[model samples]
Every structure is written in structure tokens, then in C-alpha cells.
Target chain A: MRDVAIVSTAQMTNVRREQRRNEVEMLMPVVQEAVKRSGIPKGDIGFTCSGSCDYLAGQPFAFVSALDAIGAWPPISESHVEMDGAWALYEAWVKIQTGQADSALVYSFGKSSMGDVPDVLNLQLDPYYLSPLGIDSISLAALQARAFLEKTQYTERDLAKVAVRSRKSAKDNPNAQLAGDFDLEKLLAEPYLVSPLRVHDCAPISDGAVAVVLAADDTARNACERPAWITGIDHRIEPHQPGVRDLSESPSTALAGAKAGVASGGIEVAELYAPFTHQELILRDALGLDASTSINPSGGALAANAIMVAGLTRIAEVANRIQWGSIGRGLAHATSGPCLQQNLVCVLEAK
Target chain B: MASGDGGLLSASHIVEYPYRRSTGPVMGRFFAALRDRRFEGVKTARGRVLVPPTEYDPQTGEAADEMVPVGPGGVVTTWAWVSHPRAKHPLNHPFAWALIQLDGADTAMLHAVDTGVESAMQTGMRVTPRWRAQTVGSINDVACFEPEGTS
Candidate 1:
């Protein structure tokens, strides 16, 4: 594989409801900022890829509308995925590897505040069975949480601890929408929004966008003094229905992690796109991450989850840290579908 | 739509699939069975039966058409209690969403259990489906599930 590195990243997050600007307007500055920071002229970028959910935008081909933000005047080569931006980055990486493009732009956006976020997610299910039955995202996650707890030795108190640490850590993240210290006892005393999960255990429903730029080999060296090299990246998926697969474990994540060579080197920071507290534990175990890794130094999805954007944000977080000269290597994970049905793992390094 | 300069200008937007599709061979048979208040699963190469049967086996990716009787009754493998009902939920009262394993099937199905209270639900609990008064060729024909001994 060719040496591809993420040269720059930018984001707009922790917004509870972005009522003024539409997706295109929201993404314009974020994308522009990323392109500018990468030291590559916008016109010189070879390819572009975007990830966003049409259901969240409440329109067909919303991604095309979002292209207005990128100024496709010259009719640039572009592609899209109905998934998280992390997948978009994966596509851009593929484009670079295929020799079709050396430098590429990747972006993802989500505005869950525009609709009934949980119910909107139900539409992604198998229409004949799951969707018609009206199983919203939260209920599905709660069921998975129950199964995870039953199959493992963890309990609600452990989930409460994860929540407390996440929010308290978010206090340092200026872009985090939900951040603060909370007594673990008080959090445990909170009523269940749905049994097996309290409000704290769930991520805040957020509206946000993220953009990142990728350059391969010489282009990467020229674009930035220090690039977060994409040493390994892979994604895996399981059956569509939640019933057939074991919700207690994320086989997809483990498979992806192995393919991505996560265990090849030491990881200083990790960004796991776990929308729920129990899911963090499951992904941690699935990837075989130990105590040395600083998980989610930027507060993770539990602090500000913006659906399609959250996964890509995980990649951007690791890239930012590596570029900032703080961390030598890191692991980032992104997941989609109910009960972690699909997973993508990427390993970034300073070398 | 609400109008305000404080970013409150809002309009309701709804999304729907623009096309209607056939449920295919296996699910068509499953829905037909659902109309008569019968439960069935598709037998796969792995010797497992998947409820809400599909035309293709999840494990082997082979074509699946063998339908077998699975359940009107099943055991709750795992459950999440919902203290308050949502507008779109199958039940209006408190309930639990569970993955239930029918007696003869290897896999489970997602459904709601009208347990009436959180404390009434638990793993390994026996439950049975509650059919709708009006039988339609739809998955909704069986409204939800209830405890085995409940009326």
C-alpha cells in the first residue's frame, strides 16, 4: 500500500442545534479550514469524498447539495457514502492507493437536531421487519446493553463511571456540548431513560461537521511538516439484522482491528466512537486495548455525538494529536448500524 | 413552522422510501403466515433457523427457502425495560424490548413485551405473541408479545 497521511483536520462540534446554517453552510468553513491548513491549494486537490446520511438531511441526494460548499466548478472527481465520514476517508485513501488521486478531501456532516434523531435512525433498518416495528435507536441500544451486561461481569455502576469520566474530561474540550463533573453516586441515582441505560450513559444528540485532508508520499511530505501517517486502515461488517449476531461482542471491530494491525506498535491515544458507555467497554475489549492507552482525550462520542460525523471525528482526533507532537501513535475506531453491526479501525503514526 | 430570529424558524420534514418492493420468496411466505397468527423461521445450511426469515442465510450466504414452524411462544434472551412508552412503540403502556428465542429456533427475534412494569421483565422469561384483532398481511399483524400466562 502507498504511504498516505492525514495532513490536516477541522471540525464544528458540540452544537445542540444548529438552527441557522444548513448542511452546506455548516460544512463550508470547516472544509475550507481543513484545505487551507493542509498547505495544498483547493484547486490542486485531486479527489473528494463525503459521508452523510440522507435520512438525517430528510432529502434524497443531500450529499449533492452539500457539494456546493466545495465549489465543484471544475467538475472534480468526487464520491459519497451513506455512512460516517471515517468511511469517506477510507474511500479517499483507496483512491490514492489506486493511483487515481494523490491528494484528496474528506468530509462528513450530521444535523440530528433537524429531525426525531432516534426515530430517524429506525429507517435504516430492514423495512419489512425492524422499521415497521418502530424500534428506535435508543431502545435497540438499551437491549444491546442488557445483553452485554448479562454476558460480561460489568454492571451499571461501571457504566456510570465511564459516563462520569467522559463528561469530566470533556471539560477541557472547548467544542464539547456536554461536559462537567458529576458525582458517580448521583449519576447512578438518576432515573433510567430506558432501563439498562440512563441519560448519562447515552451520548448527547448533537449537530456537527468534520473535514480532513489526505496526501500520499511526496505530496504528504510537501503539504505538512509532520503528517499523521495512515499505517493501517480496515473496516468490517456483520449481518444486517441485530437478532442473528451476538450483541454482547463486536466481532466486526476485532476483525477490522486485526486487519488494521492495531497490535503492531504502542498506542499513546485512542479515539473510540462508542455512542453508549457499555459500547466503549465492548470496543475496548474487542481491540484488546490495555491500560497504557489514553482513551478519548478529546471526550469521544460520549461527549458530543453527531451521528454520521462522529466516526470521522474519531479519526480526525487521533490525526490532530499526532500532528500536534504530543502522541507518537494512536488507534481510532468508528461504528455504524444497531448494536455495532459494522466497524472500522485505523492506526495512525508519526513515523 | 415556527418563525423567529433566534434560530427557531423550523419546518417539519419527513422522509420516505420512494419505492415499494416485494418482500421476496421467504419473507412473502413469512408474512402470509403472520396473517394467520403463525410464526415461522427460515432453515439455513448451518442448521440454524432465523426468525423474520430471509431469502438468504446469514451464515452461509446460501439461498434459503425451507420454512419451519418456530414459535407462538419463546424465551426472552435479553430485555430492556421502557418505563414510558413512545408514540411509535407497539404498546402505549410500560414494556420491554426483548430478543426472544423461540423454542425450536437457534436465533432470536426483536419484539416488544407488554410487561406493564419494569420489575416484571427479566432474562429467560417465557412469553407468547399477541395477535392483532385485524389480521393484515404485515409484520404488524402480531401486535406484540406478552407473558406466557397473561391473558
Candidate 2:
């Protein structure tokens, strides 16, 4: 496989709602900033791939309009995923592996505030059984949380602790939308939005965009001072129905982590995309992260989750830390579908 | 801080995909049984009975062709209370969404157990289906599950 490294990454400050710019307008600066930071001529980048959901935009082919943010007068090899931007990065990396492009651009954006996110996500379920019941995303996560809590030694207090730590971590992240210190008892006293999941335990509805540049070997080395080399990356999926498997465990995350060789080397920092607090626990166990690992310094999805954008942001977060000389090696995780039915793990290292 | 609904120029944009498709044989059998106030599960080659059956086994990818009777009552394997129901939720009042492992079936099915209050819900509670007066061959044919012995 060709050696691909993240050369540059940029993202917008996440907010509860964006009253100013449309999707393209919001993405332009982030994409331009990433392109500029990479020091690569716009025309020279071989391919462009994006991650986003048209459902959020309330229109089909919304990504096509987002393409205007990238300069394509001569046209370029481009593709799109209706998933998180991390998947788009995966596609671009595969293009590099195929020897089709020396460098590729990846981006993802989502304005979750555009619609009622929970109801919108319901459409992703099996139409026959789940969707007809109008099972919202939070309700589904809560169901998993209940199961996880029952089958394990963990309690509701542990879930709250994850919330407290994530929010406190977000204080250092300027791009984070929600960040602050809170009394643990007070947080626990908060009303449950759905049983087993308090409002704080769930990710906030956020609007944001993220962009990253990837280049092979020499191009990667020349374009950036320190390229966060993608040593291993893999994704796995399980049956979508939450009942089919043990909700307390994430087999897909474990499989993806194993396939990506996450345990192959020492990891200093890890950015995980778990929208619900209980899920972070499940993922940490699946990936075998330990006390030495600093998790979610950017507050993770719990801090500023923007649907399609959050997963790719996890990749950029680890890459950004590696590029900044703060961490030597790290792992980034992304999850999609209900209760983490699908998962991807990317391991980055400094060379 | 300021807030106003009419401050920005906007129009209601309703996005919808109003299309209907056939349920195919596997799901069709499940719904057909549901209409008659009965639960039918598909039998996988491994002998595991899957309610709301998938045409194929999730683990082995083998075709599931056999059908078997499941239950009108079940045990709530797991549950999450909905304190304040959303506009699109299955029940308007406070209820619990549960994974019910019906009698005679190996796999659980997701549905609402109308307990009426948060305190009324329990993980291991027994529940029976509340079939609609006039049933259709659809998932909603069962109005919602109710705590066993509820009036």
C-alpha cells in the first residue's frame, strides 16, 4: 500500500446553529485554508471526495452544490459518501493506494440543526420494523445504554463522569460549541431525555464543516513540516438491528481496531467519536485503550458533534496533534448507524 | 441575547420520500401473522428463531425459510423510559421502548411497552401485545405492548 499522510486539516467553529452561511459558504474557508496550509496548488490536487447527508440539507444531490467550494474549472476526479467525512478520507486514501492520485482532498459538513436530528435519523432504520415505530436516535442509544448498564458493572454515574470529562476537555478547544465545568451531582440530577441517557450524556446538535489533505510519501513529506502518516486503517460493520447482538459490546470496533493494528504500537493520544457517553466506554474497551492514553483532548463528539463532520474531525484531531509535535502516535475512531453497528479505526504516527 | 422566529426570511420546506414497496416473502409472512394477532418468526438453519425475520441468517448468511409461531406475550429483556414523548414516537404518553424476547423466539424485537409512567417500567417485566381493534398487515397492527394483566 502507498504511504499516505494527512498534510493539512481545517474545521469551522461548531455552533448550535449557523445563521450566516449556507453549506458551500461555510465550507469554502475551511477547504481553502486546508489547501493553503498544504502548500499544494489547487489545480494539482488529483482528487476530491466529500462526506455529507442530503437529508440534512432537505434536498437530494446537496453535495454536488458543495463541489463549488473546490476550484474545478478543468474538472477533477471526485466522489462523495453519504456518511461521515472519515469515510471520505478512506476513499481518498484508497485512490492514492491505487496510484491514481499523489494527493487528494477530503471534506465533510453537517448542519444538524436544519431538522429534528432524531426523527431524521429514524429514516436510516429498517423500514419494516424499526422505522414504523418512530424510534428516535436518542431513544435507541438509551436502549443500548440500558442494556450496557445492566450487563456491566458500570452505572449511571459513570456515564455522567464521561460527560464531565469530555466537557471539561472541550474548554481548551476553541472550536467546541459546548464546554464548561459542572457539578457531578448536579449533572446526575438532570432529567433524563430518555431513560438511562440524560440530556448531557448525548451529543449536542451542532453545525460545522471539516477538511483534510492527504498526499503520498514524498509529496506528503514536502507539503508539511510533519506529516501524520497513516500506518493502518480499517472499518467493520455488524448487523444493524440493536437486538441481534450484545449492545453492551462493540464487536465492529474491536474488529476494526484489530484490523487497523491499533495495538501494534504505542499510542499517546486517541480521539474517539462516540455520540453517547456509554458508547465511549464500549469503544475504549474495544480498542483496548489504557490509562496512559489521553482520550478526546478536543472533547470528541460529545463536545461538538456535527453528524457527518464529526467522524472526519476525529481523524483530523489525532492528525493535528501528531503534526503539532504534542503526541508521537495516536488512534482516531469513527462510528455510524444505531448503537455503533458500524465502526472504523485509523492509526496515525509521526515518522 | 436575542431570539425571534420571524427575524429571518424563511419558508417551510418539507422533504419527504412518499413511496411504497413490497415487504417481500420473509417480512410479508411476519406482517401477515401480525394482522391475525399472532407473531410468526423465521427459523434460521441454526434453529434460531428471528422475529421480524431477515431473509438470511445474520451470522452465517444462510437463507431462513422455515416459519414458526412465537408469542403474544414476552419478557422485556431491556427497556428505556420515554418520559416526554416526541411528536413521532409510538405512544403519546410516557412509555418504555423495550427489546422484548418473545416466548419461543431466540432474538428480541423492538417495540413500545405502554407502561404509562417511568416508574412502571422494569427490565424483566412481562408484556403482552395490545392489538388494534381493526388490524392491518403492518408493524403498527399491534397498537403497542402493555404490561401483562393491565386492563
Q: Candidate 2: which stretches are off by over 4 Å?
A: B1-9
On a 0 to 100 scale, what is the lDDT of residue A115 in model 2? 88
Give the total clashing residue pairs for model 2.
Answer: 0
Model 1 Cα lDDT, one tens digit per residue, A1-351: 899999999999669999789998999999999999999999999999999998887788878999999999988999999999999999999999999999999999998897888888898898898888888889999999999999999999999988988888889888789999899999899899988999999999999999999999999999998899999999999998888889999999999999999998888998999999999999999999999998988889999999799999999999998999999999999999988999999999998
Best by DockQ: 1
Question: Where does model 1 exceed 4 Å of error?
Answer: B1-12
Residue A175, candidate 1: Cα error in Å is 1.8
lDDT of 2 by residue, A6-47 (tens): 999999999999988999999999999999999999899999
CA lDDT of A167 in candidate 1?
89
Candidate 2, residue A75: the lDDT equals 76
Docking class of 2: high
